[model samples]
Target: MLRAATREAVALTGHLLRYPSGIQPEQITDPGAAPPPATEGEGTGAPPVLLLHGFSDNRSTFVALRRSLLDNGWPHVHCVNHSLLTWDVHEAAELLGEHVDRVRRTTGHDRVDLVGHSLGGLIGRCFVQRLGGDAFVRTLVTLGTPHAGTYAAAALPPHPLARQMVPGSDLLGELAGPTGGGCATRFVNIWSEHDLFVLPAHHARLEHPDLAVTNVRVRGVGHLMLPVDATIAAWIRDELGAQPTLFGAAAERAGERAGPGRPDAAGAA
Candidate 1:
């Protein structure tokens, strides 16, 4: 009973999945002789944005955003691989930190923006909070992130790693607890009212006053529809393209020194 459009879309997705669609290292670098740094503190500035995909998904999830950012002149888009089928939130955080450092070093920028989906958002938060990532990230945007637990976890197998995402589980609670470190980063959480994986839409919204969390309402979008829709991309671009509305006296002064409205001023670290 599949519609012609649906069948065509499925075939196109299959082709994209099978294609080597990632942006490689050489592709990110150049031959002007002033190569991007290999570590933090080694460049003019770090890449402007970083994209992290959700669980069971690959770097291709952010393909559209990557193209958009590049076309918008915000290059240095890197999508992370979460060691899928063997997920580890903590390790994923560490890996994310390393990638952030790499971007900082290579691009010579001190801070970068982050866009994450689902579990990738949790992992990004961990990086900002516990993995010394606050110094390198400016803005954090999450799409369909389960700030609480997802009801769909109930149907998942009782595997050790899978338990991390189980609804009402201790792991999810720990992630939600106050870590007391990455308090300065601005955050935006996007969610869909019709997400089948996460019941109680609020489960996807973070309730932190210090965090600039925006609970976006995308209509009729599913849990696994990160790249299947256009609204989320527009939301992310809008959030990242704006300046933070709140910053204390100390941070505000430092931000002013960096130049207001510029990407560097928005740098959280």
Candidate 2:
């Protein structure tokens, strides 16, 4: 376990060093170099997917996964860069709301699917749960997020957002209230068994009574690699492609009984 953690840490460091600022400005603005748009006959019923990176990370972190989705017939995939230094998760969620609205307006799609990593997952959930984002989000997929907060966060330097991520924080309390109730969006929480940053990795799972939630267990990947992991990317792509339906209260109960680390019956692409 120690060796695996060390190896993952080194790889994650390399990923961060390679794309320090996340997505490059040129990649966003280069019209001629953009990923191919969906053809008229393809992706006719699928909603556009919006990718959100973890705290202190940029849109570039999703480059590989985004490319994989596009190649597999996902019509539109967009990434957002949030303020790296923002200290409030709610504030970030508000910003994300604006971005979601813009994507809906620009694409003429009534709803979009969200894929958020780490802190980005919390931000997206805040929008869906508190900022009226459920109306516009068909599905919410989170990777390596501290849904229940984590002790690991307590070790970080004091910051409002970091404080909020500590177990039993007020912000987490508010966000945890009856999530998924009366919301039309489906929630998929994906976490890695080997994620060190999330402390007890199961803290990343969502257990809400009123929401349709699926807790997906992934092995081998670490916190930073969740977004880049090929198996995870394929699972997310499949989830996004499926039609959105409320999982209902009973189904959620059944899932809980099944416990965690259940193999992804959907398999990989």
Candidate 3:
């Protein structure tokens, strides 16, 4: 375990060194404006997939996974890098709503797919479940997101967003509420067994009586790796590419992937 953690840590260091290159200039532009060149790509009739990163992370994390998507017929892939200084999930949800609208308009598609990692997953969920984002999201795939708050947040330095992730915060209280039964958006929650930052780790699973969720268990992968591992990325592309599930009964491929390595940078969540 020690050797594996060391290897993952080194891999993350390489990502950090190259992170500066992945910075999107458009993040400084108005959120209401159309996305920049980074969001541009050819369409293959597949709904555009928007990649959302975790807390304090940028679009760089999804480079490998995004390439896998674009290479495998999921041509129109976009990413949203929200301000790291932001405070509340509710506010971030609103920002996500605006961006989702822009992505739809920019791609000329009414509905799109979402793949959010860690905190990105919660932000996407808050938008879909709280802010009527279901109308715009066709398939929502979260990678290692904490649907219920995680004890991992307590280990981080206190911040507003981190506080909201403290297991039973008021914001989580809102997420704990009953979701509408009529929500048509398909939810695929892909969580890793080796994600140490999610506390008990199972907190990443989304199990609501009202929502039909496809929970995929990934083995031997870490929180940060969920967005980058090649094998898992292929699985994600296949999941989104699969035909839509009808009558609110999406065929659940409830299983695990034997992905490589273990959890990366604890601060990534």
Candidate 4:
């Protein structure tokens, strides 16, 4: 536990250097029409993956995780950042839509995968659920994301982004409510027992009736370590490689290292 906390503190220092990274080009808005997914050799068959950082953070949060995916077999991986200055979640989602479209055009992939941490996860979910992004999102993975809203956010009322994350906020209500097409995207919601920003912990676990959500319950791993932990990175790599129908099997694999005091924390199928 001490080790994880120490790393989190170390990572905080890097945040200063990584703030507001991964800015998309303005030309993305007028990036012409979309193309089809690339086949083998042309960046491989797997869809390109996008990583989003937490509140006040940047793409550097994914330095380790991104390398792991690339070293394995994922050919195309991109890290996108949302600014803290953004006033509304809805606008962020809209901008995310543009970035997604631009990535699809660049990689020639019709659909892509998304992995988000903290506030980034919520924004990604808003794009997928509320902005009709499910059609192009193959799988959505969230680490320590407050899917049900977090009281921790209420502490920063001055930031509109923070206010939208408060429990029972209007934006939160809209996301929780029904979407017109239901949840077409495959969801892997990873919530750690060690996360404190999520307030009451359980809020990090998503329980949506319409979504095919695999609520992964992990222990000991802190919020900041989610993107850098070796084991978690391996699990996410495997999960992304697995077929959508085999999500249950992947969930079980997430806790394959269970032994002694560290019993399995796998989620229900």
Candidate 5:
């Protein structure tokens, strides 16, 4: 079953990549120069982790991370659904906060650990910075998130959503900075030297006081491959401090590493 789930997730990601959202620049309305205040941490309950995907991607990009977390004893994993039409990064942050609240209400958890990949990471960072998600966010992990503007993003059509991703775009500039950037949650940035999207590699670093930012450079990985990499998953699991019992027959293979297929993390079929 775990194998099947993993396969399904990979397939889903492929489907998402086939249809990139076409956001027009005319439709993008910046939330303005003043970003929303950072969210305050609350004692709602133990925060569950939320997974977000990048542009031209879907929630399935987190399949490996989700499986690793579950294997390490984290069962509460959810995702964000940012509409394809929305080009405003600030608005995306707000919508993400609403989903975090929804997860809290459903699971009775107070805070959430946010895991985002690529553009999704930027969106999550904005949530903690502009929206009030920091109040309910315990940790923020980003895989291949371009803290600075990427060459590929600059080359994209001048869509509002595309412009927001540029290094100095109003939204990107707000979230991309020396750690803390006025955020109130733990932050982790994971990147690959061979990434096709964010080239030169240095664009993925985040340094701030309030944030525990770690710029991990991995070899033999690409932008799309980083999020699902087993080594990367294990690194995130260790950072989050979760450890699950690898039990049953499936556990044998699951122990191969934090990459995928852990029985304890998935339900028995």
Candidate 6:
């Protein structure tokens, strides 16, 4: 127990030091700032990616993972800096809708992908499932998000959003309704076994029967480290680049079939 606590503490400290204000302009690539020229073999023509940080965190929270995506061929990566003072997840989701629209308009892409961490993930789901954002989103990837709400939040102050995150909260109950049905957007839920904030860890999984969901279990990483972990970043990059599959088993098969040095019968001339 002490070791796990020590690890989480170190990871949290690193996260705070890396993005004290949650908005580090130098580390992230802003699509609005001078758009990068599309390069062959790069993320050209791919869907634009919009990153959302966890609660009380800034766009800087995605610094490491964004760098990894860019380094791996993802060209258009953008981050949204939501205010910590915001009290409601629905309001945050509304702001996310605006940002998604802006990204689509500026990039000239019909759709974009969303990658959210922790509280940001919940906000993203609210946008996609509740705010009609599924129309504009191709994929929704979340890391350490509590889709089912978390008991751990019960210990926090009863802030509006905080209250919404506690297990059995009204917000979660409403969100758990018949949403995500017939939505075109795909969902990828990733969580760490050692995540301290997402009590029971399984709360991170999205269990909607109609929504196409992929639950990824990651071990040996803490909740705070999900965005910074190199392995998780690589997995996310690959997932973004590849076509979406039905579930984890199909995704694995798809990966094997598309592995390097393999001939593509579908693309053969």
Candidate 6 per-residue lDDT over residues 1-269, each given as its tens digit? 45446767887888778776566432332266434433222366677788988776788778898888887767678888777679899999998888777766566667788999998889988898898999989889999999898888888876787788888987888778887458888887887667889998879777776677777766556788788876567667767887453234664543222211124312111
| lDDT for each candidate structure | 0.63, 0.75, 0.75, 0.76, 0.64, 0.75
Q: Give the per-residue lDDT digits (tens) of candidate 2, residues 234-253.
A: 66776787733233456546
Q: Which portions of model 2 miss their true places by more than 4 Å?
A: 2-7, 21-45, 179-181, 243-253, 256-269
The C-alpha TM-scores of every prediction are: 0.73, 0.82, 0.83, 0.83, 0.70, 0.82
Worst 10 contiguous positions by lDDT, candidate 2: 25-34
Model 4 agreement with the true structure over 1-269: per-residue lDDT tens digits = 56556767776676556544444422333346655557632235778888888787778789889899888878888887777678888888898887888888887888889999998888888999988999989889999898888898878657988888888999889888887766779888878766778887888888777777777666767778788777778678766886442234664555322211145433211
What lDDT does model 5 reach? Answer: 0.64
RMSD of each: 9.0, 5.2, 6.2, 4.5, 10.3, 6.9
lDDT of 3 by residue, 37-111 (tens): 333223377778888888888888888888888887776677788776788888888988887777666656678
Superposed Cα deviation of residue 48, candidate 3 (Å): 0.7
Clashes of 2: 1
C-alpha root-mean-square deviation, candidate 3: 6.2
Candidate number achieving the greatest lDDT relative to the actual structure? 4
The clash count for each model shown is 9, 1, 0, 0, 11, 1
Query: What would the per-residue lDDT of candidate 1 be over residues 1-269, giving only the tens digit for each residue?
Result: 12323533563575367335543321234333435443322122334687877766567667677777666656567777765555578888887887776666666667888988887888888888767677778788877788787777667666545567677777677766776644667777667555666667668767654454555445445555544455456545655766343333564433222211224433111
What is the number of residue pairs that collide in model 1?
9
Cα miss at 93, model 3 (Å)?
1.2
What's the lDDT for residue 237 in model 5? Answer: 72
Residue 230 in candidate 5 has what lDDT? 70
